[model samples]
Target: MNPAAQEPLDPRDRPARLTVGVVGAGRVGPALAAALRLAGHRPVAVSGVSDASVRRAATLLPDVPVVTPAEVLARAELVLLTVPDDALAALVQGLAETGAVRPGQLLLHTSGRYGTKVLDPALRAGALPLALHPAMTFTGTSVDVQRLAGCSFGVTAPEELRLAAEALVIEMGGEAEWIAEESRPLYHAALALGANHLVTLVAQSMELLRAAGVEAPDRMLGPLLGAALDNALRSGDAALTGPVARGDAGTVAAHVEVLREHAPAAVAGYLAMARTTADRALAHGMLKPEMAEDLLDVLADGDSLGDTRGGAGGGAR
Candidate 1:
């Protein structure tokens, strides 16, 4: 037998069944632990920062002990720092200062915008830092726990930690996608722009409908909006509709005027987004490239489209 072939594979080179300790047992931590447990990982500990966190941990992950961060670090081979984004750095620093971080351990945080840099202290202590963010919203309910099993998670780490994080993601029943460190912010921003901003947009729409004396707001626009969102997700950018997509300068001007009349505060955001949509429409070949400049100028003026161009034709309202 060859010398290399005769040697046993190093443990680090192969996937190891890890004992996980979830820190910050609020909405995400317990949900993640439950998902991991369902996928065959052991939940060794859960650390909570506040009374609410403690109660949440008890309610969601009663099997796991609610302990201090130090205790969690001591017990778990992989420490998941699922604390609030603002607290992650402090938590890592604190753990390092206390010498709680174990050598040859794994440290992971779930913040979408942050990379492994936040866990530098833990990394310096010989732990490999990984950043894994599930691309799903948590509502702090059993539903969220259930939903986590099928979500897509963004996994980022140094070369040494990449396979380990991917294995964990796979074990959790989530699709693991790698993101480049520099692209993380743009990746996160796109999700926020599409998902988070949709909430605000829907709220605005519901408020407007209610103000217009729609007795059952949900009955009126909820299905319509839901279908639109479904279509957007299914069709991607081809779901672009309304005035800009059709190069309907008249309808576009009319909408700006009406929004200014009825919802003055919405005008700026409306115009800004309209300009962006027009750009997309042009890119999609739905609108002429020449039309984009005029549309942009009209939106930029924000007062009126005095010389608005383009005929209203085939766009969905």
Candidate 2:
């Protein structure tokens, strides 16, 4: 067993502060750097290409100089790579090829989809790789720092560096949830399905509501959506409700027709979600097969609804 793996790092009492540097001033990097600064780590440098990023770095990391990526690595003991998922590998390769990675530096990336494998090049250059992806959304603002207080971070690192990774997340006021290297992709997909797709579904629902003459769509849906989310979180599949769960085939069929007429683009999404909801309801015994027969037929015919748009009959009214 590696001795360092068992050592606990004090979040606020570490006298030996590692100078932190951000390689991309995207929302995540600056916010994380700001949080670390709160825990007594010095933010030395950061790099960002866009004007917005420069402004963001200045806001979150006041007095911390914005420098080139190579300069950031040269100046700091801990480097945060907060680039997009697609750009991460290439950026790491570029840094390594340029001989910029400092030996023994804590090289951490904030990408959820990748684990330590993507940091292998940096690791070969004598860097200690860490993957610490915060499982919370970033709004590219200071509020993101506050949101980290009770947030969970998806952590992945070599066994020897697990303590180091957890310490970093803890220092940022986050819980460390260790994800296996092979399971990182699946973990990220689950998050995206829950968080990212939720935004799309809400936006579509709001748009359809507006088209149906509902004013203040957000206001109208806020309480209902909030309760639904809370219920699902608390009860899981037992939280299933609405026309689909009740096997109200007529109501489901009417919803399909309204979406087809009022918002043609939302028809497919509505159908897909309804079908998924029905499947889950059935699996959980919330929906009976005999009752679902007509509901299934309605969903199965969703593809043809796009072409045969009739007058809107039923909606949020």
lDDT of each: 0.77, 0.87
185-241 per-residue lDDT for model 1 (tens digits) = 888998899889888887887777787789888788878988888998899779988
In TM-score terms, which candidate is top? Answer: 2
Scored by lDDT, model 2 comes in at 0.87
Could you tell me which 10 consecutive residues in candidate 2 have the lowest summed lDDT?
308-317
Give the per-residue lDDT digits (tens) of candidate 2, residues 163-239. Answer: 78888899999999999999999999999999999999899889878887899999999999999999999999999
Query: Model 2: runs farther than 4 Å from truth?
Result: 1-15, 307-317
